[model samples]
Target: METVTRRRTVFDLFVIDADDTLWESALYFERAEEDFILLTRSLGFDSPSVRRLVHSRDIERLALTGYGARPYLGTLRAVLDELCPRRPSWADSAFAEISRALLEHPVILLPGARQSLEWLRERDLPMIVYTMGEQDHQLSKFSRSGLSDLVEECVVVERKTPEALADLLSSKGVEPSRSLVIGNSPRSDVNPALKVGASAILCSRERLWQAEKEDILDPGRVHHLETLSDLPSLLSFLEAAPDSASRDL
Candidate 1:
């Protein structure tokens, strides 16, 4: 018997974000933070002050911890220890509850996430869910998301860098010009796409995290959309319009 390997499919690749882009992620984090804040306030710390410290520490720890639910919870725990040197009897259990809630939260897909992906799938668009975080945790979420069948693959990295994006396209034999990166983060999604000479679509959200905030390097090269539902229409318009006209859009 001879072994045969199928060539990877190549097309105008769609690189999509997972957390807070296709599903409800930040909301659970926000809930956990609020719970932590309440717990700390019960211990006599000011709510706003604890929030400020937690926010600062979260960003500071990213260099060491990267991004994931566990690392984020670890940041909160560190903050709690800093504020309250003497460990309370019930603190550990309460914090564990918070961590469990966040880690085990249901995968609630964003509006039109399914419809948009189905539309692209029906058109034979090659999509890869390119996200960054702890591999097992992210893969667990992807499995529960009910979107696995629609996309070709889900890629999890520790971070999203220009070089990372370039390497992903290279692995798929996809040209940068024939790629579209869609996500909410200006720092992670839009900037990397711009750096790789790929088209970008920013699905803007009201409560993006501080670390994900950054001025887009080239706003003119990125398309802005309110939700995933608009994606199919945008693609349709781009396909119908002349290349010169679509460039400005």
Candidate 2:
């Protein structure tokens, strides 16, 4: 008797997330948060209280304002206004500067971001940059990222849910089983993708948006790679043992 190898199904469509996955978006926001803390502390507000309030308001405002640089800036400003009714001139100026910094920040690729993307391009995989944010901002980041020439398109959305993922996959005529969703957040990337029967690859990062973290229901179809560069090897392994990918770890 001879052992048989279950050939892995080739993932034709690869939809990758922007932000913390490819470039350093969250880092700037984190820095801005620290700046906000410093500014509020200078205005007599407790640093810890300012951070807590900013985080709280940012999350709550998402449903109403959607995700974007402006919304985040607004949340921090709102916190400042509520705590200090008579905001100083410098406070407003500082907030405006912070907003400009976030909006004008360069798209700095991560350590293995470009190399990994290049590898995928060489392999000729159908890859798309799918992210949730203000359309103009997200597209602008893509243009500056140096990856615009590599990927077919950069998609912007207000939210990434199972339904949204399903629609994207369907629009491309790619079945869930033959598609891959890679991102840092489980809320916006992994869980919703898995729910739609699509395999997800998490570009794991230490510090991520609090809301993006969610429970993974189907770990079998999920693959965790430390960096984007690790993807080629993982895909190779899956090619050899496709059916066993879920239990490989």
Among the numbered candidates, top lDDT falls to 1
Each candidate structure's TM-score, on Cα atoms with residue i matched to residue i, is: 0.93, 0.91
Looking at candidate 1, what is the lDDT of residue 202? 96
The most accurate candidate by TM-score is 1
Misplaced by over 4 Å in model 1 are 1-11, 245-249
| Residue pairs with backbone atoms closer than 3 Å in model 2 (clashes) | none
Cα misplacement distance, residue 18 of candidate 2 (Å): 0.9
Per-candidate Cα lDDT values, in order, are 0.89, 0.84
In model 1, the Cα lDDT at residue 176 comes to 90
Model 1 residue pairs with clashes:
none
lDDT of 1 by residue, 92-184 (tens): 789899999999899999987989999999988889999998999999999999999898699998999999999999999988977889999
Worst window of 10 by summed lDDT in candidate 1? 2-11
Residue 42, candidate 1: alpha-carbon lDDT:
88
What are the runs in model 2 whose C-alpha is more than 4 Å off? 1-9, 242-249
Q: Measured by TM-score, how close is model 1 to the native structure?
A: 0.93
lDDT of 1 at 241: 59
